[model samples]
Target: MSHALGIAWDMWSVGKVAAVLLVTFILSQLLLSWLHAVRAKRIDRKVAQLCEQSPKHECQSNPPESLPVTLITGFLGSGKTCLVNRILAGDHGQRILVIENELGAISIDHELIDEQAQKNAPSGVIVLKNGCMCCTGESPGSELERVLDKLLDFSQGDSASLVFDRIVIETTGMADPSPIIQVLLRSEMNGARFRLDGVVTVVDAKNLMRHISPQGPAGFLRHRPEAEKQIAMADLLLINKVDLVDSAAMVALTCALGQLNAAAKQLRASHAAVPWKYVFEPELDAVGLAQRRQAALSSDGAAHGPRVSCVTLTAADDVPLDALQAWLQRLVQERHEDLYRIKGSLAIAGEARKFVVHGIHADIQGTLGGEWGGEPRSSVLVLIGHKLPAERLEKEFARLSGSGRSND
Candidate 1:
């Protein structure tokens, strides 16, 4: 009788265990089913919403068309801010949102610009503080989704009609654009909430040579990989600061750029002044986007091969016209290799109009800009190069301008 009792107890325990397992499986299945149903409904709702916004078309079971996203990338000090500012200040007839990623502890780039312009601007700015979007050894999907949710909510909520026309992401100078591109591609796969329109890269025409040239042993480690990746991934390349480089230099740079990224469409500009339509509304075909994606993916990690620096000088007084011209000519001739770029607004004696000057290597140009503004006329020049004699250049400028004083 004791043996019989033991067998019955064992059977009871097994039955209880089986019951618990069955219940748990059922609960898990139910949860998964509910989640799948929720996802389906959400996708359906998005599809309906997209149909409402767009022209009447046959709706397949696929996800809706996503918000267009334009990525703007470049190396450090490559006029990215100027390009973004132009987009914000433009009259594109549609609202835009900008995602700004910075590499420093604090986001001072936004504060340095004019607040009023931003306040009145068409684009609403969002900043990702402290870290770069690409280099943190983490996927950008979660971070991007977190910020993009705001735009999604605005569009999908009660105000469905008020949707942002497009989104722009301005990456940090040190950022690798491949990871960022992958993030958007993933988002599209999950649901077409965001579609990559194109990548617009700003190349500093004056400093590009320095960034691309081969570095020696001492400087090899100092090269920038991000710069090369940026060029490789660009669908639209803006060779900015064109005024700084002469025609021959421009031709040579263009040829080199084609070698770097043959797929990208190139545009030349000064002060990032390309038309908003060209940068924002590029003629992007499916093949073009795919090619650009492949180009980015194919590049194994490579560092930027050049070392460059920037030097800025200011003159508070007016300079003689002939002296200014001769000084700039001589400076270009002497420091052509070391001098990558020079741009400035000069206050010249006996001249009603200000001289807008740009210099690249041995090429120098000075054009008469409009009249001076309300403030006193002065000369402000920014020079970029591999190695520059900052103090000597400042003193020479002072001597030429007859100011006896210059600030950097």
Candidate 2:
């Protein structure tokens, strides 16, 4: 140590000590890079072996066109999963593959699956919790590529049905979206399979104030970057749980969130209840959602926990317009307060156009969407709430369509 340092600490000058420390840091970084490379090479070899043993599971010879990816980030208790569920439930004709990224070592979703179910889980991974799967693993350098390859693999020579239209990644409340963004947007390989759609941030209206702090330096917004940049760097801000607060409180929360990210679209939502169109609109489709995204790419990037139930009711036949409308109206009128989110698409009995359905507390609305064309004329409704009676709702939805079908 002395030989490297050149002098004892007591004898060393400030400049000399600083130089030594700088050299030490460089060496440490080099060592870390070497270690990472070694680990990555080993992972590559193992993956190669697996592919060789099972050629049908090999990565695609030609990667699919880039799929848009939406990153869902929020503070704990901020309703990230609620948003996720709403998206998955919506029959928007978009095949979305969701990746649930948890911060800690154990995956709550994985733990719930029994051994057989785990083994039978689809080849494409939907959840990669434990270190956000971005910053940890044997091959940090190519982990995202490897995951995407497996999920998008078309080894069976039939490629038409195996791809996803989009991917949505939900991060743990404590995660900073910055690192995840860097790993995704900055990588050349990631660009081939994915383009960053936008960053949607969910904030709890009633508890947002508790997480804010005085503005710090370096482009911190007036809402000044607290709650782990979950609010500050948002592209789309969902001021969720608005039903919990009064108008005055809502205004205050809205103003604070606006100051944090004035450029972001802010929507007041109760129970993450938002229409698929509004939530997934192509508002950012052009070379646009680009500027802010670029700035975010250049920049840097908790928890509440909630358990809820999701029930999906599907019927093969078309739903009678009157019966469906009456059913939804009654649902919102009588039980909307208990319902967290309700959204789906439907095929009205005689209507050629698809039907868009969405409802929040005390309100439900539908729009005549495009024709189903070759797609099945079926109705799927998803209900997310606490302690829901699945059987009753399922039966109601089935009766609307009046068809023999499986209900799960």
What's the TM-score of every candidate structure? 0.46, 0.45
Q: Which residue pairs clash within candidate 1?
A: 224-304, 225-304
Q: Give the per-residue lDDT digits (tens) of candidate 2, residues 1-408.
A: 876676655556877888999999999999999988886676545444333333232457655456677878888888988887666555567766666654332224554233543343444333222111111122233434333343334322223234457767776677656544543443232324455667788988887775663334731243323363666445578889988888776656665554344335677789998766666652421122223223323433221112234455667888888998798778877776556545556778889987866444454556787778886677666564545577888777778777724232
Where is model 1 poorest over a 10-residue stretch in terms of lDDT?
Answer: 130-139
The segments of candidate 2 whose C-alpha lies over 4 angstroms from its true place after superposition are: 1-65, 103-161, 187-191, 214-228, 282-408
For candidate 1, write residues 241-349 as lDDT tens digits: 9988887777667755554554467888898988777887765332342343244334443322234444456666788888877877777678876664455567788
lDDT of 2 at 353: 88
Give the deviation of candidate 1 from the true structure as CA RMSD: 23.0
> Cα deviation in Å at residue 157, candidate 2?
14
| Pairs of residues at least 3 apart in sequence or in different chains that clash in candidate 2 | 76-303, 76-304, 77-304, 173-302, 174-302, 178-301, 221-224
